[model samples]
Target: MKTVILVALLLLLFPIPVLGGESGLVISSYSVNPSTLFPGDTGKLVVTVTNTGTRSAEIREAVLYGNGLKVLSPGYSKLGTLTSGGSVDLTFVISGMKEGVYYPTLVVRGNDSTLQYPILVTVDSTEPEVLLDTGILYVNEVNRINFTIINPRSGDLTSIKVRPIVDGNVYPEYLYFDRISGGSSAKGVFYLYTTKPVETVQFSLQFNNGENVRYTNTTAPINSLPSREIQISLEKYPNEVLRYDTVVFSGNITNLRQDTIYSLIMSIEGDGIVSSRDVVLPALSSMDSVPFTIRVTPISSGTKHLTLTYMYSDVLGKIYTGSTDLYIQVPDKDVLSLNGVEIKKDGIELNIIGDVSNLGNYEVKGVTVSVLASDSEESYFIGALAPSDFNSFDINIPVKENTSTITISIQFVTGVGQLITIQQNLPVKEKPVLKEPEIPKKYYILIGLISVLVLVVVGYSWKRAMQ
Candidate 1:
């Protein structure tokens, strides 16, 4: 009984040795040397890893990886063995060149399980500014834009670029610089093309501080010229002329203000007129008159109302419009008229004659003359007639014994799809019939006496033969 008690006590004193599951490792604490940092700044990151299981853990090394942060110091460190509940500290020196929140991952291998630790770091901000030397923008010319990049943080800024966002187009979209030290500034130039007028323009600034990529956007007001500073005058050729005449128009654009103008264009528009050209001027100086001409031919005769429009830009590239009106008079024109008609008889056919005259400003086409009798019609084509000209035509038709009247038709077509017909009635007078000459009376009485004598001789010869 004493031996049993002694064994029990000994067994209780010394525990039995048994193999169990693998060891586990975890991150105990983590810290960044400088908790707060700005772009283009350098700082240290420290991480403490501990073995939390009952057994010892053999770790190969600790590795770190993250975006927006460049590792300046060694990223890997050898951690051979970690006893139960023991802790090890690992460090990395990293630099940030862009502004944002960054999460770094730490990996440790060679133990029963792979251990990963995630760390968060925040980077401060910096920005730049842009200004236009001129108050407003103008069309058809290049405008200079100025940019100034300032470093507000304690670190250096690099890869600084300022870009202008315009509604139309801009030359050299961006201005770039290599570096700008902290608390200092750098200058750049950007050429912009403001094809149209706008109220404001946006400028975007992109740059990299040692620790982060930074961005900023700003807007500025654009001053544009108004139409009140422009003067326009219109002059026309041959103030009083006939229809279809070529009207030459001259327009003068004068800049009343001291500011210079660009892209001066004049356009003329009206009804019943055709123009072959538009006037454009490259540049107009201050207080100067730019003259431009346009030729237009009027189609119809009447009062023609013409509108002249002028568009131009100021020194800053904004567009403005102005207009002027002019009135013209075109005289009326008479196109065609029927002169006269005549009819005569020739053998068994009747001849119808008529004359047509063209009195209009334009040529008349497809003119034809036809004689319409009671039964049928006979036509003679006259083809085309020039202005202020006349032509005579005759059509012959066979008529029955007593036809006394006939009608005439003159049909013509204008080039613009207008058909005109003229009609006239002519009286026909028949020629007098001729009478045969009467035979003489004495010749008829002599023939009667000869016939009686021949009859008396025949009777006497018959009576003598019978006796």
Candidate 2:
């Protein structure tokens, strides 16, 4: 008895182990469509049965039974034989009648054994999400609104479609997407034309849970902005321009509206004699200002017409253009003139002296005068002559006896830094010819004869007066 008791205790402590073969027709993987369900909504439950054993297994029936989650399809029967390491799919249609959580049992019966597995199913009646974003919409033009449909379930959604519900104008009334994985999101887009003070925009999304069709909607407010005029003024510009006056038309371009300006450009086209180049400022934000300058050079004198043109576009793809006209009168007067000119001949040289005056309204820099005589050339420098100002210049150039005309050139730099030279021909003065004191050729004898005659007449008149 003691030996049997010891053997029993020993056997209880360390029992003998029995090893068997691997399992066949196991429930390898299972999934419920739209893993979360809604009341009265139908879905699917797919179970993958694999033959992981050394030999094939014959599947007799694959069925599902539960109290809360209702099964609409009958059991899968006579599924044939599954080869070793091969697999087959078992699908069942299921639904929920009320909002609650349910545990359903999957019973797989094979020729060798029977197995039962419980799957947790949910029926919370939670709806999917539809998000709408109207990103930077402009008034009275084509705009885009984005829609993001999110699936909060554990299974994927199918045949998803979104519709933009707007009472106003829009294109392609609806947008379609094929599918959205469970717990993931999908995107959709719609183009709409909106006006200022836009109305509320709404959206509706419809999809399938592999069994029944479901819907989700949203009512989002649509926002839009209007275009305000850009402020432009000629802040620092000359009202009149000289023949070669390079005047800068500087102004401040301000964005008074609530949107950024795009591709802003200012131009002064080549209008006959008035010419300029283009100035550009790509973008300007709201309430921001940018200063610009355009250099103008006029080549001719007239009632010249110029325009300071500006152009830009908005986010709505509409181009806005404006112009500020400028009228400048260029007088037909010589820029430099000579005053108080005097010429004299001294021996074999000619002296030329004058005051060089700037007649235009602009200053002339680096002024000089040159004289070309018959036998020689001369030059004088009179630097930096302001408008209506004068400077003296004198030149002594060698000349021949027969020299009659001489050339005078006035050279200077314009206010805009241009070298200019003007030439004029002047007649040289000749020396006065003098004869040795006029010999009274018989003139002295005739004067003595006149004096004798006057004396005789005076003697006769005196004798008569004495008598």
Would you list the C-alpha lDDT of every candidate in the order shown? 0.69, 0.75
Judging by TM-score against the true structure, name the best candidate: 2
Model 2, span 1-467: residue lDDT tens: 45644653453344221113244656677777767777888878887777777787788888899757889999988888889989888898889989877767788777767766666677866666777655455564446677677877766778877788775566677778888887899877777755555656777878887667888777776566764568887765666666655566778889876567789988876454544457788888878998877766566678778877888876655677988778777766457888887888887788999999886666778999999888578999999998879999989988887888888888887755667787888887775688678867598889889899899999999989999
Give the runs in model 2 whose Cα sits over 4 Å from its true position. Answer: 1-30, 37-44, 48-60, 65-74, 78-89, 93-136, 140-220, 255-264, 270-273, 281-288, 312-320, 334-350, 353-467
Index of the highest-lDDT prediction:
2
In each prediction, how many residue pairs overlap at the backbone (N, C-alpha, C within less than 3 A)? 20, 0
How do the residues 1-467 of candidate 1 rate in per-residue lDDT, one tens digit apiece?
A: 45644553453343221123267576766777445466666878887777777888888877888766887876555578889988788888877778876767677774456665556666765445555556755444455556555666545667877777888667677778788776677766666655566777788878765445668797777765432466777664665534443556766778765556789888777886555467888888777987777765555678888787778886567787767776777777434556766677866689777678876545657998888775878899998888778999878898765777777777876534356666667778876568887768887787777777778788878888898
Give the least accurate 10-residue stretch of model 1, judged by summed lDDT: 12-21
Q: For model 2, what is the alpha-carbon lDDT of residue 359?
A: 69
Report the Cα lDDT for residue 458, model 1: 82
